[model samples]
Target chain A: MLTPARLAQYVLPLMVLGSTQLMASTAVDQQIEQLRARVSAHSVEVNRFEQELLHPVDTRVAVFLTLAGRNGLEVDAVELFIDGQPVASHLYSKRERNALERGGVQQLFTGNLSNGGHEIKAVISVRTAKDQFIRRESVHRFTKSTGTHRLQLALDAHAPDYEPDVTITEWK
Target chain B: MTGLFHSWVSAPAIKIFLLIALFCDPAKATSPTVPEELSEGVVRFALATGDITAALPLQDRLKGDSADYLRGRLLLESGNVQQGLDTLVQVAQGRYHRGEAALMVARHYGAEGDADESRNWYQVAAKNGFGETRQKARFALAELQRHAGRLDAAGKTLAGMDEGYWTAVGYLNLATDFARTDLNPSRALVSLRVALAMCETDTNRERSKELKSRLLVRAGQLAYAHEDYDKAIGFLKKVSLDSYRTPQALYLHGLALSEQGNYRAAMQSWHRAKKYPLAYPGVEDAWLGMGRGYDLAGYLGQAGEAFLAASAAYEGERATLRELEKRIREAGAYKSLVDDARNADLEWFLADSRTLTQPRLAYLLGLIENPVTQRAVARVAELEEMIASLEQQERDLTVFMAALGNKPSSDTQGRSKQLSADQDALTNAVAALSGPNISPAQKRHIRELRDALNASGSVLERLSNVGGGNNQRQPRKRQAERLRKQTQSLLVEVRAVRDEAGKALDRLALEFIEQEDQRMAFALDKTEQQIAHLYEYLALKKLDGGKP
Candidate 1:
């Protein structure tokens, strides 16, 4: 067991361990210098990321305007005029009430305005068993010229979520 | 005792000991109330044989009498009530473990609604120092009082707990005592609250916490009934249903939300309360609260849905005479949204259409804020519809423009000049040098007609190129002219089209304004609701236990 080969093996392992320790210490010293240089040259941009063009409230809107009542609500009557001449009204209070009550009320619109100001008026009145309330009145203007006109009509109606998945999928 | 125990299906002490063991080391998950091995075998045997007969023969080999009383209970639970009763009766009359046997027999009789028989055995067990038996005796007596409509007597009997047993259980009983009577709920709450504080261990604390939550909810109900909205809100505040199913508490919370003008929050609370499977009679009202919240908040769509659900749920439910109409009214409120949303949509759409463009954009913008603040469904619909119109108009403009690519601009100046020259010479040419062929007035009119012809020159030039332009300009121009005779009409349509490229500068300006206005409404409404909710919550809390 105490042969020259054994002594040589033990001595070689000791030498290898000593050299590795020496190398590790020098490596640590070199890394410290390199880190200092990196720190001195550091110029980082701290930018805040932003999400653009994603609007949170772009969904179509639908509402059935009515005056509150003790017994039940009443529908709003709509009268439309083009240049002071009575034009066809797409919606009247009674028609609106029946359609909305029945369901799947999607307001569709077409045709276009060739720019410039046009006036629109909306009035809502509630007639009930005991009293009547002129709930809402408004007049506004719309203008379009030269290009294609985009028109959106929304109807407010909420049914139930009890329909089967297949039925709901077919709504569109 | 063996005879009695065998007749009883098992024994009593063994069952409780097993349960205690299971409770002690919960880290070791158990398969069922019975041992896992017993469960598998029993289940298999029961399924295979369609009765307990086969299970009995195979199950007798399993060694353990620890759950003997529980075994009898299992029989009862499995719907063999008569057999279970006989087994427990035999055990009670057995020589060994007389106290446990008597307790089981008492429970069996009590379960069967045989109060007299249960009381007799309970008394015997109580005399024999069975603590649980003594409590049953008290409960039975209280029930008897309850059945007899003697609220005071029931409460007194419950309160007659021995001083040694004056734990949270006693307080809970006291709460129940108050619940069934015309007593002050606050007093009942106070009693329970004290008991909650008196809990000595985790189990007692957990139990007391639940009881306290329930008591507070009841107290809230009483206060709410007395029109003490703030007090009721406080009672339901910060209570979680993790420990106990408490619909009354949630309902009170919703009630407070509605009172505070936080209709959306109130709706949420009521909706949650409606989800509770075991609700009080007021649960129906919780559904009503959801509809009412939406109606008040102006969220017609959600309100209608809530009302309809409430109506459906409460269909054929019994109610007080006054509540009959109230229920119908709630249902009717739901029906109103159809018209409500319509009105809102039309009104909002009209306003939105006018306000979304420049010059009048700011003015129309203000009209929608209040409606949006109310969360009007129709208002939302109109906003969306109008935006869609604007967006479409912009799209069509681009498509038509693309279609008319490479078209030359028209030049109608020559015709205009010729017409103008003729108008100047019309009177000179018409007036006969020798004789007055036309009157002075007629001559002037002829000159004006020539001038009008001169004016038509430019119009003709517009027409000439309209026929030759890209993609037939005549039809489009005519369409535009039909909408309005104003000059400004031409400019808005011109800016609307877009290719695959981004929207034209003008269209962008217009569309951006419209979309931003809509987003502003939703934001404003949401913030207003939130602020109102906070204010109400704080105000109610102040009124409940502090300053208002």
Candidate 2:
């Protein structure tokens, strides 16, 4: 039932079609990859523009949030105020809370602050292991200099007190 | 440090890269090395941000294998591909992440069209990697060899790479390569049989089933085309009834049977094919074939009835196709096309049967599943994304401009005077150093400083002249305004390109639908012609008073 020589003559077109289809698929794949790379590169350019021009180093201030301890303090929400003006606020999703617990630092807010004394207030809501809800407020006053200032809010809940100890430290 | 950087200034690309690294953010430049205890936290932060430029300085402070791996990744992310490949090669030489690094290097070389290097790196990845990575490398290596027309090598490379989808696909591709290049049907059939066996063991159940059906139909068609009735029948008979290729396989099987003088078996195959939707491949042809089979078997009454059924089905199919063509023209089908176009799956063409089976879209499956149409549709989606990104950049610039307006005037004036004073001082230093009293080494040092200063001065001039700002703040504001303008122009260009791409997709879709409609029309004409032949034969027999 098998005739190799004659069958080869008959099936040549089909083989050509199959190879063309495969090559077309590969070409499409390459085009999509190139497009993805171009988009990524464009995004980086936009980010550079934002960082260098829009938010100049002389007046830029970044606020970062970090969880310092493994105590049973589950952050529900955190709201930030600068000079009594509402600036940044976020309600923690389970995933975000887990990331914070695993030593991930979140940049809560970044904006320009003129060279002068400014007041920052952080209102944090937390849930204890016993299902008790507690709200705590921490205020810190720091003078913004003519250079970039990065502030980190370290929230630690130790066993003895389990009070939300908010320590505000500047990176530079 | 200044002299080293100054020497690099001769190369503009390196200078620009170094400038971004050194001056993009003053905070990074001033910060001390990250503490060992804090490195993990910093790494997490960098990963969370997903910004290569932002995390670059951290790479300098972080040590060990993970940091090197991240540095390689960051270089790639930053679009410094050559540097990234070099870094990855170093990482591949290390004990940790060697397999992963080698995999990356292989992929990079593959994309760069360095086939030999790509093959070498793929072998290295296959040797060092475990599980998925090793399988992927082997599959890619096989693909590269096949593309290079080295069928035997491709097959050997795929010999023992896992028993899953990739391995099965490799064999299938190898079979195709053999057929196209060697034109050896025997070898191709052997490879196809192996591919089918591999398909049965593939973990991806749905994909394997789909691929198996397609392979069976292809093999059957090849045999049938060569007049090998028994082989064709054997292959076609194995296709599952519910498979996407069922109608095509049945039609081909009937043809093979009829050629073998088995009219009853042929009619049965055609009847089974008719039970499928008329929109399916070969169903219309099968309907006509059924009528002819009955006529040839001397069942006149049954043949007449079969002709009537075939005519009715063709008329209905014609009506449905006309309605679909009308809808395509009215853009009612545009949304569906766009939705399907966004499918990023690599095997989308092979899997399109699932989507095209919808009642409204079934008849258009041939056109929609076409690779050219899919490519056009995907291009349209990509263009839309580009336009969206440009618009987002414009919005960011708008916000930045608003902030610029609120900046204090005193700060602006002070910075402007400082830059101007610095520029004047640098110019005076260069002039003073040009005197003959200077030592040769000192003269060369002065020349280097002058060149670096000249470079900085030109940048300052661009900022000052464009903004018409006598001060530093104006330059920043002008820069934002300039970017906003550039973004707006790019948006216009991208939007125009997207419009053209969208129109092209519409054209391709409509063209496909019209072509399918034309095909059905031709089939209907042939069915009518066959019916007329049966009617005439019956009339001649009745008039002669022969068989009756």
TM-score of each: 0.30, 0.53
- Write the residue-wise lDDT of candidate 2 on A1-172 in tens digits: 1122222222222232232233222444454454445545555555665555534565568888889888888998999999998777887755567678877677677665666679999999999766779899999999876567778899988776687778998766
Looking at candidate 1 chain B, the ten consecutive residues that score lowest on lDDT are B1-10
Tens digits of lDDT, candidate 1, B62-86: 4344234434544443345566567
Docking class of predicted structure 1: incorrect
| Model 1 / residue B492 / CA error / Å | 84
Instruction: List model 2 lDDT by residue over B1-548, tens digit each.
Output: 00111221234333233222223344443433233445556666655444333455556566765777767876675556667889999988888778878998987776555677877898898999887788878888787777777888888888877776667678777876666766447777788888788778866455666678878887887778768889999999998765667889999999999999999999899988887767778888899888889878888778778878888887787787677667656653445544433332334335433442343434434544565665565566566656666676777677656655553356544776689789989889788767768898998888777766775665455444534332544565687787777777666666666666667777887777677667777887887887788778778978999863
Q: What is the DockQ of each candidate?
A: 0.01, 0.09
Off by over 4 Å in 2: A1-42, A45-172, B1-124, B127-129, B144-151, B176-190, B219-280, B289-336, B340-356, B359-378, B395-483, B493-518, B545-548
Backbone N/Cα/C clashes per model:
56, 1
What's the distance in Å from true for residue B35, model 2?
14
